[model samples]
Structure formats: structure tokens, C-alpha cells
Target: MKIKCSKILQYGALEIVAIYFSLLMVMSLLTGNLVYRRSQSLLAAAIIVVLTSHLYSDRRKYFITWGALGTLLASVLYIYYNLNDSSQVYLAIKYLSFSLNESCLIILTVSMLWQRTKKFILVLLLILALIIPIVFWGYYLSMDAWFASDTLLAVMQTNLGESKEYLSDYFTVSGMAAIIFIVIVAGIVWRNMQSVLLVKEKKHFTAFISLALLVSATACYKTRDNLILNTGWKAKENLQKYADFQKMQAQRKSIVRLNLQENGKQQGVFVLVIGESQSKDHMSAYGYDKKTTPWLGEAFKQDNFIKFTNAYSCHTHTIPVLTYALTAKNQYNELQLENAVSLLEVAEAAGYETAWLSNQIKYSAWDTPITVIASEANQQDWINHNIGETTVSNAYDLKLLDSLKSLKLTDKMLIVIHLMGNHGSYRERYPRDFAVFSDMSSEVGSYDNSILYNDYVVSKIYEYVRSLPEFNCMIYFADHADAVEEKLGHDASKFVWPMTHIPMYIGFSERFRQKDAAMVNILRNSQDKVFTNDLIFNIMLGLMNIKIPDIYEQENDITSTYYNSDIQRFKTLYGQRFVREDLQ
Candidate 1:
């Protein structure tokens, strides 16, 4: 058997076409993008045309081998750069590893189509063995709980503008199935080749065997480097980007020092309850049909709870929202300046024993300066409770009550309680016993129950605050709202601005209420439809009745507006400014 030019051309075209098809199939499985499928087909057609041209001219191993190696290497490097630069290296490796592992099986199939024997079976098994390590690598990169289907879907939809459902349904399942299909196809090709080929054609099979082994080796080595490069580049980029962002942020940070003119004013205790993932729309207090927030509704009607009718959170996520809300710049652009003085720091400076108790895991991390300010007390005395122990559960807001009880409050105390209220999966956030509604079949019932549980927790906190003789004022608001459930056709994780709109209620003790009646009424009627999270700093200033410096008083001062406005100007000016700066 002599190596004919036509035969070489045919095999080379087949190899290129097979590789292209495998790439497209894997990409389609990973991204579920129709455009990618079309692109893959076009590229494969081009490769076929080019190979046919080469065969028409003369048989050349150099063109085929070099082209295959170059294209594969370029693709691998592109995937690496995108993943590394975007702080999504894990996902990059995951998708690439799966693609290559699947491609190896495809290579085996193509190889066996040319020549099959014990050698082909051995090579197939070798590739199959490789799949285990690749799969394990994918799993290792996805160690975080947020990488779960629900969480990742939400995150992808928010960041990428594509629903996780696309990735989950088509990409993930189909990719795995395609990999298995390739394995099966390889076995079939091997059996078919063995039946067709005899001992006389053995010499002709050498080129095909060498091509398969070389392709597999190249892919394996490239995939390994892809993982290493992605992870290494990600770490370097994060540090550099954070440092650059911090430098930019520092240029704009002009911390205002309060000038205290009055010396004899009596110091009082205040509590700010920061609720997590609670939507005002679900609360009866906000006129929802369900009586989920009965206690809060009663409190609001009685004028005990001075409700801010239109208040929105700065950001959707806990870390971003908490950071922005507490910092002087309650916007995303100023996120790098998170270490700047917060309301807690201001309160602490004013001779208040500031204590922070949180049910959030991330809040316990010392990386955040706001967390440090909140949990300034001794670690032994600080309450870092994890109430949500179940797989899909969130901590009950009532858990904060026990933590609060442990704290020794002073006359001038600023207690910041970060509650795990209504943090989803909705059903797990609440107890089964709280499923009072008859219509328990639907997701709405679960949400209503979760809202009710949150309400009950709020009531308990209120009762505790009311019992405290030294506690003069209290402010409560959720960090952000929840999205509709998964079954509702809406992405349950994408936070709408309306979803970020939360209820802000402030209450004062009888004595403090009488003394600050004018200020209270001004706050009640303040028409400024300012963002609630931004009010943290100004509210602290107002409560302490201290004069803030001119530099901090420039941008949309809620206090200056008497907290009254239906302008919704916060979105237009403040929102656009941050977006513009972020892009720059």
C-alpha cells in the first residue's frame, strides 16, 4: 500500500472537518448560542475547501499538521485571555476542559474511522481515562456554593444579559451528552475499521495513528496550560485592577468632619436594622393583599413607625449594597473607597459604643472595612451567628434577637444588626409551620410564608427595641428586594431597580419623639424621593444634629430636601454618573 496524494488529501480534509465539527458541538453545548454553531460550520467548510485545494496541488503533511496545531493553540489562548481578564477564569477552564475532553473522544472516533485494531481501543481507553481528571478539574473550579445552577444562572443573567437557563438546559446537559456520544461513536468506528481493514493495509494506517496521537497530546498539553495561565493571570489582574481602582477612588474621597457646636445635648441609643433580600411589595405594610407584614402595618398606621414611602437600595448584592450604603459615596463607582468613614465610624466618634451583629457569612470576613466598623467589639463578644444551616435556607431574622440580648448596651449605643430576612430559596428561608395560607401549591405561597416569617422577626426586633429604656431611636430597611421565583418565566436572580426598592421605617421613643416632633414631621413629609441607602450618612448627621462639612453636602443631600421629593432624580444623575465613571 503506497501513500497516495488523493488518499492523504481525503484523510486530512476529514480530520479538519471532524475537529471543526467537534469544536462547534462543544461550544454549542457550553454556550447554547446558535451563532457559535453557524460560525463553526462556516469555519469547517473553509477548512474543507482549503484541504481540497491542497490535495489538488500536491499531498503535504506540513500544511495540515501546522494548520491544525496553530488553530487549536490560538483558540485555547483566546479562551484563556477572556476568562483570565474577566475574573471568570474558573468558567473559562470549565468550558474549555469539557470541550477538549469531548474533542479527544471525537479524535478517537476519527482515528478509528481510518484504522481500527487493539491499538485504537487502547487509545480510546487512554482518552477516556483523561476525561476523569478533566471532569474533576471542572468540579474543583466550581467549589463555591454560588456556582450552583440557581445562583450561577442569576449571576450570568445579571452580568452577561443571558439567562442561566440557556447555559443550564442546552449547554451543560448537551455538552455532557455529546461527550458521551463521541465515546460511543469512537467505539463503533473502531469496530467498523477492524471489520473492513486486513493485514495488507496495516502500513497505510501508520499516518492516521500518528495524527490521532499527536492531536490528542497537543490538546492535552494546551488544556493543562490553559488552566494554569487562566488561574495565574486572574490573580495578577485582580490585584492590579483593585489597586488601580483604589487609587482612582482616593482622588475623589473628601471626608467631611462634623463640627459639634452644642456640648450639653443628651446622648441617646439608636439601632439600625439592615434587612437582607426583603421586598416591600410582599409586605402588607406596603399594601400587599397578603397579611404577611401585619405587625409592621399596624406599627406604620399607628405612626409609631415613620415609613419612607419611596426608598431604594444602592446596589442589589449584599457586599456592594452594604459597602455603598455605608460609605460617603453611596454609588458603585466609589466602591473602592469602602474603607472611608461609615455611619458607624461617625457614631463611634460621637461617643457611641458601636456594635455589629450579623447572620451573613461574608459580613464576618475582615476584608470589608464596613464589617470591621460593625464588629468593632472583641471577637468573643461579637455575635457572628449562622442561622441558615439547611442547604437552601436563610437565617431567621429573629436569630438576631438572641444575639442582641448578648450585647451590653450603653446609653449612647449604635447597634447595627444585619438580618438574613427573606434570603432565598424562598421556601427554605421560612419554617414549614409558617405555611398558614391554604394555597400552598404555588410558589407565591412559599414567598408569602417567607415574607410572614420575616415580618414576625421584625416584630420581635421591634418588641426588643421597645423594651430598651435607653434606646431612643431605631431605623430599619432592607438591603434589597428579591426577584420573582424561577417558574415565573423571569430570571429569579436579576435584581430590578423596583426589586431594590425597600421599606425604610424609623421609630423613636416617647420622650425622644416629643422632643424631636418637628424633625420627625419634617422627615415624614420630606418629599425627596432619594435613595434610602444613601441616607445612612445624612441620617446619622441629622440624628446627632451635627453640622456636616460643605464638601459632603453637595450631592443630592436628602437632609437638605427635608427627605421630601418625588423627583426620582437619584436614578438620572447619581446612577448615570457612576455608570459613566465605571466605563471610563
Candidate 2:
């Protein structure tokens, strides 16, 4: 009796050890000295697994094995399908692996509790694991129509519209056939899983459950990856952060009353273009060796255009940089930008019809930071997909031309066009005919070609507005620039000069600068001044001849006579301080 009790204790200890190591593998940062929270929970679950199997006199662990395998396969397929575009393939793989690791943790934990859960409950769990990929089909399907990568910001709160945004694109005969094939394969895998986990003996069932838990946990921790994997169970974190961030943008009031003035004809159009992953260093207009931007180059030569030589993005990533670019926020007053009226709000208040047109994901804006600014635009519509990042797309920027044509000419109108300009997997950005740069390797050549294509798109937009009446101006700047060579691409941990030095120029119609010659000179004189994009909110206001209250700083505005150019005050997003020469 004494010997049996000791052996039983040893058996329990081994089960606990397996779960403990597994927890450590996924969560290396998880620290616990005196107590083991994970160990206790796991031990309890293991005991439940044992007792439940014994009570049922069942040798079958159908739920555990089948569910885990199904989930594992589902997760892998989901990732393969939805991976976003990355200039650095390694970064793409790294994030994919991280997300998969979290799925494994879920699988293991779920497997251990399968039999303990009711049959109906288990079925629900199985369906959930199976459906995650389908939930993304909407975005992926539309992507094939024209597509690319996007992040959590792109996945607004279980939005069915977003989930099925590409349904029509994927439901074609061939697409339906592919879906049928997947369903068949899934059925087979689940059936096989049942057979594989079936046990004829009760002892075999208990031992298998215990050993499987222990072995899987230990092996996971023993691998080269140092930290334990995070569960990341909370799926809507980005949506929540977006909500919290927006309240700050709408709620804060710095002035007793808002005031705005239209410096030009209140009857003209102002187009502000927000470009993605474009760098000034690569643009011909900015004097790169390659003529990557012939259209912009010609525009630069025109006296109506004022190109800035030292403009920087506030952050290297899209969300952070654009949050400030579209609103009145900077690196210093992050807290204040919250509740600050965005450019669209100001434009609307001034009785302008605001329109936002993007070749990016639409559903992402519903709950992300982009929504606040986009909400200001009466015509803001999504034109892209939240599909996997690296998928090739033949969709061209010119597709937006039709939409722009529809807006027609309007008085006191503000149009914002967001382009998927020169983002990675660059070959997909342009049609094969646009591939003009030949001497360089395909990677670099593809990038330059995308820029060239961008030049065409920008010129088309300029020509359209050029035909419009009154004092109209067209402004183009990148959300943030990319270092095409960096392994993590532009969102690297450290600063690289090229990543923040994006192309920015105000292309005024012949009529716009003529409205006030002194205004043009003020815009031209501030050309060489060191500017950060976070000041875009203020810049947008100033360009429209809108006078902000005395509260907001004027130094960030290019059109302000008081625009600041103290070399000492300039700083990049990565905290590197620079002067005029440093920018060069």
C-alpha cells in the first residue's frame, strides 16, 4: 500500500512537470518564484482528464486529438492565407511563426480539456477552430480581384462586412471548387484524427493523455525559441486601442470656440494624397540617380510646385505616423492630439465636402484610428483588401481614376486619396509593362518601377484637378518611408535616415499660387525647412488659408510666415536629432 501511494505521487509529479515546462516555453517572461499558477491549473485539468476517462469507462480521447490536429492544421492554413506583404521575408516568417506558436498553445490547452467539456461544447470549439480561416475569406477573395497585406487595424471587430468583403470575388466557379476541395480535406482530416486517438483500453487512454501533455509541453520549451508563447486570446485588442485613442481625438478641447478661414477661393478643391512606403531618396523629383518619378519631376520643375527638401515622418509605421498626419498631433503633444479636431473635421466645419478614397482596406477603418479621420470624409470608401501581405496583385493605382472622375468638380471640396504606393512585393504594384528599370536586379527594379507607376498615377490626379476651376492645390506625401533593404523593412527597431525622409511637395494649380503671390512665396520659402509629418494637421489647415486658434503651434506649418526652422529643434521618429546637412 505504501509503495503504491508513492508511485501514484510520482506519476502526478511527472504530469505537472510536463505542463510546467510547456508553459515556460511559450512564456519565458512569465515569472513565478513561490507559487506556480500555470502548474496548478494544468494539474487540475490533467486530473479532470483522468477522472472523466475513468468515469466513462472510455478509452477514447476523441475530442483531445481530433480537435488539436484540426486546430493545428486550421491555424497553419489561416496564416499561409493571410500573411501580409513584407519587404523583408524574414520578418514575415518571424511574425507568422509567432502567431502559430500562440495557436499551438491553444491547441494543447484545448486538447487537455476536450473530454471534460460537454459534447455540444466540444462541437462548438471545433467549429470555431475550423471557421477562423473562412472568416478571412471575404478579404482574401477581394484581394484576388486586386490585393495585398494589412494588419490587425485591417480587421475591425468581427465585422461581417469586412469578413465577407471579397465573397463575390471568391465565389466564382473555380473559387467554389477550391472551397469544396478544402471542405472535403477537412472532413477527411477530422475523421482520421478520430481513428488515430481511439483507444481500446482504459489504461492506454489515461497514459496517452498524460504522456501527450507532458511530451508536447517539454518539447515546446526545449526548442531554440527562448520565450514562452503568449496566448493572445484577446482578439480585439487593436479595436479597443483604436477606440481609446479616438476618444482622445474627439473629446479634448483646447479652445473655447473653434475658428477657421479659407485663404483661397472657398469654391475650389484641395486634394491631399496619403502615400504608403514611399521614400524621397528613391524619387527622381528629389534628385535620386534614377528617374523614378518623371511625372513628379516635371511637376517639381514647374514654379507652381513647392518641394520640401527636409521633411520627416513622425513614426516609421503607418498607424502612428498617420494618426498625427491626419490630426493635430506631434511627437511632443501625443496626449493633446487626442480630442484635437482632425483635418476632415475642420474641413467639414468650413462647409467643404470631404471625400476619402483609399486603395487600402475599408473594414479596418471601422474601429481603428483611421476611422476618426476617415469619418470626417463623406465619401471615404475602402478600395483594397485585408488579405495576406505577399500575395501578388495586378490591381493598378489607375483603378482609382474612375472614382476620382465621379467626384467631378465641386466648390469647397477636400479629397484625400490614399495610395498603396511602392509597398513591398513591389512587382505586384505595377503591370509588367511598367517595369522600365533594367540594369538592377529584379527586387530593386520592381521598386523603381512601382515609383514610376506612382508618378503616372500622381500626374493623372494632378492633371484632373488642374482642369478644375479656382484656387486648387494638390498635396502628396508618404505615410512613412521604407528602407527596402532592412530585414524588418521600415519598421525596424532603430532609425535609418532614408525611412523617415519621405517625398513631400505641394503641387498648386496655376490658379492656386496666383491667388496670393506672397502665400506662394511663404510656401516656397519654407521649402528647405526641416519638417515632421505630424504637423500635417496644421499644414493642411494653413494650406486652406485656415487660421488655427492661438493655442496650436505655428512652427510646424509650412504656409505660416512664422514657420520654425531652428536646426536644433528637428528630430526624427527614432529620436535622432539632425540638421540640414544631416538630412542630406
Q: How many clashes (backbone N, Cα, C below 3 Å) per candidate? A: 8, 15
Pairs in steric clash, model 1? 29-171, 526-563, 526-564, 527-564, 527-565, 528-564, 528-565, 529-565
Model 2, range 489-558, lDDT digits (tens) per residue?
A: 3542334667787888898877767776787898888888888888888888777766657535677777
Per-model TM-score versus the true fold: 0.60, 0.61
Question: Runs in model 2 with CA error above 4 Å?
Answer: 1-239, 245-267, 334-338, 380-395, 493-495, 572-584
Q: lDDT for model 1, please.
A: 0.53
lDDT of each: 0.53, 0.60
Candidate closest to the true structure, highest TM-score: 2
Q: What's the true lDDT of residue 255 in model 1?
A: 43
Tell me the tens digit of each residue's lDDT in model 1 across 1-584.
Answer: 35697787688777677756665565444444422422432343335334322311222333343333233322443433433244443344443543443343343344344444556565665465444333332322332111223333233222221223223322344345544654564455444433332122545455645554455554444454444344445444433433453443323323432443342465777788888777777788888887988888888876656887767766555544665566555542344443445665455545667777776544223434444445443222333333222223234556778888888777777777777566655665677788886575556677778889878887888788878888778888887776543332122122235456578888778877787777777666663245557656666667656554542343444545434343434441226322222212
